[model samples]
Target: MSRQFRLPLHSPPSFAREHFAASPTNAQAIAAIDAWPRWGDGRLALIGAAGAGKTHLARDWALKANAVVVEAANPLAAPLDLAALRGRAVLVDDADRRAQGGHLDDETLFHLINMAGVDGGTLLLTGRLAPVAWDCAVPDLRSRLNALTAAIIDEPDDIVLEAVLRRAFAARAMTPAHDVYPYLLRRIPRSSLEAIAAVDLLDEAASAQGRAITRLLAGEVLAFEGDEGED
Candidate 1:
């Protein structure tokens, strides 16, 4: 029988500007954020897949711009009140969700876009889908989204993937031996989300077994992941 372990629950890794790993995949997106205030119409959209550094970049830009960060889960939530924001810059992560089905609400986001543009304040939105693809119902909202400058975080290459894997391990306070990184990199899919998830699972496995990360342990974890079982 296979043993099981309950993974500890924890908040996502806290974002910090210095901790972000930059590569060709994300340089353009980072550059766009760095060029803030100068962005045309004072707004921009960043599109990338999960774990593609969109949140990290958004958080860094928010810190630099003194912007308020809000998820697209529900724009009407307590903090999205325009009156409360005044003329502050705002960074909305997963803004694409709002486009699809009003996860952030078209009405509130429309107001936010206008507010962020007022008085040189800027708006930064991050999501997995491009603004052009947002299924907005409101005419004004559709036009506004269409007009915003857009950037993309491309799929990571080997170097960036390795960096991301290392960062994930570090976030859990586990330092994998030098060889462990290359080993996993060679075996796992070349995706930031996948790499992060693998690291998370490996960390929990190690924690449950009271073992340091090693070639054997990593192989065990990956082999278990490969088993689809009695499907």
Candidate 2:
């Protein structure tokens, strides 16, 4: 087989509502967001593991509420105007990572929570764990997290995972064998993150080896990754 150089291509993930694979798994979170201004305490955390569609849902809420979206890491480098955020919708993505990431300090985080909690603003935070479980240097911040309401997004079901896999491949403009989904679904861990990883590994293998992705290629890749038989 003739080899072909595969240049790295980047396809940014879309956060639009239409791009989201909505299902009962995330319906609770979606409903919590839609409940909006009436949210108990005016603050809520969408908690889930990676690729569980937290960011996508956050984006959808941001659009509907005209919420300001900011990475948890950006605050310390460029602090936001607390007064301006009052009575508005704000989303701080990856907020739980900030405590250990050294991107957001306890004081800043404390104020963010305080502002929304007491000042009539609506705040949304996304993370894999609940805010109360996060490691916080400030005792005050830790206390506030306990009062913060939270919504959980369960693991993606078969339908959602299938949609995720299909969309990921389509986004990369790669066409695998028609049997790819069924063959791999029962074999790999049932999670969107895992599905995307499978597609990524296969895509890389196909490009590097200059061959189309088939069950054989996929199996080789999965075996190499040791991600098989985890259904």
Candidate 3:
């Protein structure tokens, strides 16, 4: 006989301001995003590893600039009316991912770039690497992309990692003991992405068990690391 399974309902939780921990590792990127209107050039590129807050910063800038955010890879089902974007900003996230397969052809991105140039509007592109590293067929698009200012978020320091873990836990309304952090620092992968994943898994397990996060829960998650270690 087959047993029926019931999946838990998933509702997104709202994060409090206290849940966003800032650190020196991402301070420059955050500052640049905060000073959007005053930036010298209209075009900006944010480069960073996964889970380095690139998407968060991009969204923040888009909201402040009152702009539209588009994915760089796939073509929009309906093209955005150029008139609508005039004087407003545009943000493209995961742009490098599009570059791998020559997905961002000149026809798609060039018009947007030209429009921003003529309208004095801001255009922000985010990716894992600089524009030069991206493969493009159009000479003009390549040159134009390279001309934009590139900013990168380096790996977080130990202090930042600790703060990140604490904040992530707090965001889920789970309070992890102070001691659990030190244990995580020693055993978990150094990559912020991994750290965030571990925190998420621990939170999920704790929520299901109706208990606070602890080293024991953390260990169970860490034990599955097998060959895929942290970056």
lDDT of each: 0.78, 0.79, 0.69
Tens digit per residue, CA lDDT, model 1, 100-194: 34436788888888876677678899888889788777899999888888989898778888877887787789987778877776667656767
Name the weakest run of 10 consecutive residues (lDDT summed) in model 3. 1-10
Candidate 1 lDDT at 219 equals: 75
TM-score of 3: 0.78
Give me the candidate number with maximum lDDT.
Answer: 2
- Which stretch of 10 consecutive residues in model 1 shows the poorest summed lDDT? 1-10
The C-alpha RMSD in Å for every predicted model, in order, reads 4.8, 5.3, 6.7
lDDT, candidate 2, 1-231, per-residue tens: 111122233566788888788789989988887788888878889998977989888888888888888688553556677778777788989988873445457887788787785656788999999887887878888899877889999988878888988998988799888988787776667567677777888888899999898878877767734445532
